[model samples]
Target: MPKDQVLGPDAIAARLADLPGWREADGWIIRTYRTHSWKGTLMVINAVGHLAEAAWHHPDLTASYAWVEVRLTTHSAKGLTEKDFALAKKIEDVVGWQPGLEGGALEGTPSDPRFAYIKHDR
Candidate 1:
């Protein structure tokens, strides 16, 4: 498929199903990654940036101390496209995501100290 080809709802829906937290909004595929600390948030942002650069399909990212909201759309297509969904999946992989899982768990934990702050009572 062409890099910037726009995708319809059926295709989009089918792709989004396996993507878990990502959703369609304002002509973009969006997902907010939650983190345990500011450091964790930056880590996620950096990982996303690296993936986007590697894929050559960048997304708009809004990063705060505790989260990053990623918005993907193919500006050249002026709408949602395969590039957007394609990158979203890769972001999911790099972020250590498990589909259908929520943000309560520490995703990258011991490897990433920022995610190591919490202790379980049990």
Candidate 2:
């Protein structure tokens, strides 16, 4: 329950089950998001930055022309903790959300390849 408590392997694995593309690697929970181009990659990074800043729990992100890998670990705890999992869940929810599929006013970006952004996983 405490933020400083380190999670064991089992706890990490259990938490990762709810996160589709996230995994427990070494001492962090990580996920790599595939983007359509450099622009999409920057968008993902910026979104993650805002979330991390708001939560006050930053993550290490590796970005490329087409992908961004998010790695979260609780620095204060020196290992995986609730902070890592919480931020990871928030990142996943925000990054993977598709308002268009919900059929609301926001019809999301065009599905066409010419205007597509992040390649949402099925």
Candidate 3:
């Protein structure tokens, strides 16, 4: 679908509810995962790579030693769309991980020292 004809917030939210671990940001959907190490981070990237190729949609990705950030937006469409949301949902499902119950805890909160050293790229 053309990005110009992308879905609105209401449509995006309806679909997003079905996709766990995704949150809205600047009219786009984003999800981040914390891995044990660089190897685990690459594993997540590889998984997302396959998904993006299969869908013919790409996402903005940032990776560190223990974290991978994925931001989905349809640059061609100039905003969010069903395609972006679909990809975000697929990533969340296939990654086999979810954010912590508390906001930003899994990403690394003071209480959880396990992932405290990891840094995410925006």
Candidate 4:
């Protein structure tokens, strides 16, 4: 594909093959990063925002106590573009992400059954 051009379905699929946790969804490429705590989740979100701003390509982000879902699309191009993929790659790098690293569905499960976990001193 040409530099910074909007990618079609085939090209998007090919590019997505290399992006482990990302998937095509409703005209955007999306991924959810799971963290062990709210603090970790916020850390990831803020890092993404910084990277997006630095790259001049922002993504839609949704955050919860332990997870943040990122949806990337080029609003100017009206579809996916190389910029989105580039930003995703940068975010993945700084976040130290691995596919399913948070253990999938069992992720964020508290060690204590009471769900009243305490933070440890740093």
Question: Against the true structure, what is every candidate's RMSD?
Answer: 5.9, 0.9, 7.3, 7.6
Over 8-115, each residue of candidate 2 has an lDDT whose tens digit, in order, gives 988888988888899887898889999999989999999999999999989999999999999999888889999999999999889998989999999998888878
* TM-score, model 2 to reference: 0.96
Per-residue accuracy of model 4 over 71-103 as CA lDDT, tens digit each = 999898888988888888888776764323457
Task: Highest TM-score: give the candidate number.
Answer: 2
Candidate 3 lDDT tens digits, 30-81: 8888777787788889999999999999998998888898999888878888
Worst 10 residues of 1 by lDDT: 113-122
Candidate 3, pairs of clashing residues: 3-77
Best-fitting candidate, measured by lDDT? 2
Model 2 lDDT, residue 31, Cα:
94
Tell me each candidate's TM-score.
Answer: 0.79, 0.96, 0.72, 0.76
Q: Per-residue lDDT tens digits of candidate 1, residues 1-122?
A: 78678888898899899888889987999998877778778778889989999988889999777778899999999999888888898888768554224565554345455434222211
Q: Candidates ranked by TM-score, best first?
A: 2, 1, 4, 3
lDDT of each: 0.79, 0.92, 0.77, 0.78
Worst 10 residues of 2 by lDDT: 108-117
Which is the better candidate, 1 or 4, if ranked by TM-score? Answer: 1
